[model samples]
Target: MGVVNVTQSQPVASMPEEDRKLSFREKVAATIGNMTGTMHNQIIATFLLFFYTDILEISPAYVAGLFLVARIIDAILVPVFGVFVDKVSTPWGKYVPYFAILGVPIAIFGWLTFTDFGLGANGNVIYVTATYLVYSILISIKYAPSNAVGPAITKRIDDRISMGQIGYIAIMLGALFASLAFQPLYKALGNGNDARGFSLIMGLVGLVGILVSIFQVTSLKERYINPNNSQKTPLKEMISAVFTNRSAVVLYIYVLALNLSNGIRTAIMIHYFKYFFNNEGLVVIYGAVSILPTFLGVMVSGPITRRFGIKINVLAASVVNVICMLSVMVIPDTKAGIIIFMALNAITAFFLGASTPAQGSMMPAAMDYTEWKTGKNVNGLMGSIQGFVQTLAMALAGSIAAWALHVVGYVPGVEQSSETIFGLKLLMGVLPAFVLLFTASILWFDISEEKQKQITKELAERRQQKS
Candidate 1:
């Protein structure tokens, strides 16, 4: 799984003469690059299913199958890719080159997924399978390495948190833009031929995202403490390292739960809006309300983390999210009721967004722990597990939504029954709330903020001594 490279051979502790700290501008540029990459992902994850089903007229079953297959492939490939990333020594550095080479293709595939070329059901399925596979692979390439790069860029705990805040703000904005634009863009492009237009717009967005990522690659510098750029570890050793790293395992479970909760929320949104509110346009309203809170939360996360700590913030936010989710169960779906739910949901979004930066920043700490404990750095492998967990959660959420629709006797492309409609309403609101409660419970196991700082300081001290 890993490749050996011809680079300076030294122990992980071999210290360079000087530590290169990134300038604030370089950090900001890096954050923007990371944000663009994540934004590209959010657009596809949030809207791709809806686009395929509603606009492209693909079958729910087929779409589900495609997601399942692609995810399975991704799960296997991600760890291997992680090893590959760890092994390679490039002029651009270990992890940044993937952004340059694969970023554009990733965006191109995103556009292709939204395009409707008048392909019949069978033809469309084939086209989607091929294109989607390419999209998944390219995304894996860019995502796994980019994730690994975050830690490589800086060893400063506070700086990493700050970088994560900037990245989170970017991600929230990207999500907000996609949420705000998808429906209007689809409509403006002409409902009949809008699929093509949507595809084009997404393609352009993807291209712009890639270019932004490239700017990050050129502008940001890696702060390598260990000057020894040695041959990559073997695949067997990498896998062993990943499995043995308890912190990585805990973080993986945490990420999986987070994704599951979020995925359920996303899958149920369309159903909730259409049936409960009796206004399809409420989708935009929902997006606006939810994202606004997230925007505010991301803005304050860095300072909050600095003051209170990541674990406490995450736990507090999870509790708030649970309250908000339960509130949705009590609120009806009428205009006034919807407003109340949206307000509560907005609060939930704020907490979730705020917690996300902390969680993301913690990942590098986990990677460092793995390296310290196991005498190896497997950032790519760790990130691959993260990617697998996230996509797996999305696949499960999609499947759950589809199956729920079928159980409630939801008929696509036709007028729905009252019972079916009622079921849809429940799925959108109550189901996600239940999932949130479960996620909140599991999140209690996370490491405290003080503990994280302790871990970071200890790892750095160890590296300093070894060097």
Candidate 2:
């Protein structure tokens, strides 16, 4: 519904590979890029908070504030960087250089984020926060541009849909890879002292991830960068268009909730399984099993979406996520609890993957709508907000988990009080369920299938005119 004013300047055009379908090899390469991008973050998300609380001995409340403040800073930077991407280019490419060149710094900062050089409690607070912020900046540079790559790869719906599943599959693979390697490497390197082990583990693993990224990214091409977008389409107008597109707004809502819920759950899982379930090792099982279904879901999502359409695909995924999380509200003490919880958790992960392609398609669709309306591409600006949503949710998740720990009287490496145990249940289960359900409700307002067909037709004609 938001109309961008483009009368002031005309957009210069290039050949956009909007309709080109990727080959199997190209898809594999992109999947590698997506996988590598996810692995380092998954490492941080899975273990950094636990390290902060248990190893560094930072206060939970202060840790909460630390994460939240970084998010606030990240929120501001995401937009600035978004506009920067929209307005700038490099010899390497518009979006490619950010990931290709910046990958080294990202790995370095990622290592630094986990390293502790005898920083006292107060010093650790400052040091950890600084490293985290730098890491965030490097990630923002890499991730914002990377987000645009999928849309750039191809504009065909079926490809986007398949790419979505592939993208999510890649993400889960990264997370799974992190989970498998993280526990063993840290424990082995540290000689049972995880705090000391992480610096070594992160540095080594992060380097490998970055290397894979370089190989993967260089193999790919950016066929869709519109060189004149920034010259003609002002930043203000592009930002305005993001809000006016209801589908984009829906994306914002969905991402915020999705990231927040997942973050809270991820940030708390080590604690949840260890203290509440009295089976700390189950955390590894938890990681493996929860992500296992993603592959199956990805395989089936294409057929499912073609049959049901995108709107229903996304809605059903979120709704089932709610149900699965709700079923996890109470963890029983018997062996049956482990079996039951893992089963439900797998289902939750399945939907998460099943809906991924559909979810992935939404942002590109929203971007196309904006371009259709204004004849300008603002993928960079839109991608930044999506990245920001992840950061914002991660920030809130850390803060909330820490705050909840305080409320629950959670003491590290001790038998938790009954209230603490119950609180963990609610934090991991009830909270995320409700958040996801709220996210699903926003689906009703999304752009309908018929509307999308019309938009696609009109945009194709417009592109032909420019060609």
Candidate 3:
């Protein structure tokens, strides 16, 4: 075992040897698989709270509490799933075997959440809560494995960067498709019953999620498994590793802030458009206008990260986002003003979206640091811990948004006071801007490109000697 090689700078991508480069097919398959996971997330984040509040007539407080409960359950379970992944090995692969087992359950539970099932208000809450827990647990089980694959697939930093870029592009595309399809699907299927529409849409999306998940499982190739290491990491040790790894800890805090902000923004957008603007249809238009620039962001993220370094790229993008969001907040609420503001928001999303790949690529490097320091490869633990933190942040945001809505005297399907409108504006703009500014400032990762290169070279040497 060697000492941990943590450094105090962002790691830039370096060209891998010829043998280490991933095939185009492999990259596509991973991207598609990642897209499926993100699609599920997009649906839940962007629409779930709105569905419960608006269509089902659930109080925002109840729904927010439900979110809180589910996330807490998930946060507790995340590390257990990580340990399980580390201990398990099978014919399929160490990381992906659970994918096949969890696929059907994930799909079934995901679709169930949107259904009414003739349950009364109290009964519906119970049903929704139970179903959400199941779906969240399944996601916990599956996401760590999928995320851990980048490190398992290759030791090459550039390959990891490439994979992260492709994976985030998949995420953007999935969110894009959801945004584009949601209004149309709800309109066509629900007619007057939006509840039914949402259920059917989720059903279709869930099935696609299952198929693409399976596709991702089959397509991925895990090349860096430690053959001699079959022992499961103890819970205590996993906890120790989490705090001990400075890079991982910093990332946890960073992602928590980012996701919390996103959760608030997404949970309130429909409300902002529907109640505040008095034009619910504008939600669709906003989604449509935002997609092009967001797509452009995903397209260019790889080149930008490679050239300017991930930390610089993310910092610059986030600074621009802060300005854009503040601009939106100050703009008057006219049709043209809103359109222009949405366009600017689109640019903000572009910069924000561009930061994702760089953020993701950092985790594998963190895992490398953990292993180099502790003599144990805890990639699953690292990934799941991040997932756990993100879930917690999202829960915090959801609950806060819900309570804020209540405090502002928001009533579903009714006219709101000026106070309510002001709160909605804060959720959409100022709150998120402040949180994002914090996100940019704290992204000073402690792993330089040079240090990462050294870590990788040493890890390879260690593995070779073991083999």
How many residue pairs collide in each prediction?
0, 0, 1
lDDT of each: 0.71, 0.76, 0.75
- Candidate 3 lands at a TM-score of 0.83
Clashing pairs in 3: 7-446
Over the stretch 1-467, how does candidate 2's per-residue lDDT look in tens digits? Answer: 24644332243342345455787766766656677678877777678888889888888888778766766777788878888887777777777666667677887888888888887978998898888988877776565677766666666778778777777878777777786777888889999778779888887867876787677667777766566666566667877877878778878888899888887887888898888678989887887786658788888999888899888878888888778777767658568998998888898778777788887887877877777777667788888888888777877887788897788788998898888888888888888777776687456555665666556656555555665
Question: RMSD in angstroms, all models?
Answer: 5.4, 4.7, 4.7
- Candidate 2 C-alpha RMSD relative to the actual structure: 4.7
Ten contiguous residues minimizing lDDT sum, candidate 3: 10-19
Worst 10 residues of 1 by lDDT: 1-10
Q: Candidate 1, 282: how far from true, in Å?
A: 2.4
lDDT of 2 at 250: 79
Compared with the true structure, model 2 gives a TM-score of 0.82
Cα miss at 174, model 2 (Å)?
A: 1.9
Q: State the lDDT of candidate 3 residue by residue for 334-422, as single tens digits.
A: 88877787778788878866777777788888887887777777777777877777777877787788887887788998888888888
Would you give me the overall lDDT of model 3? 0.75
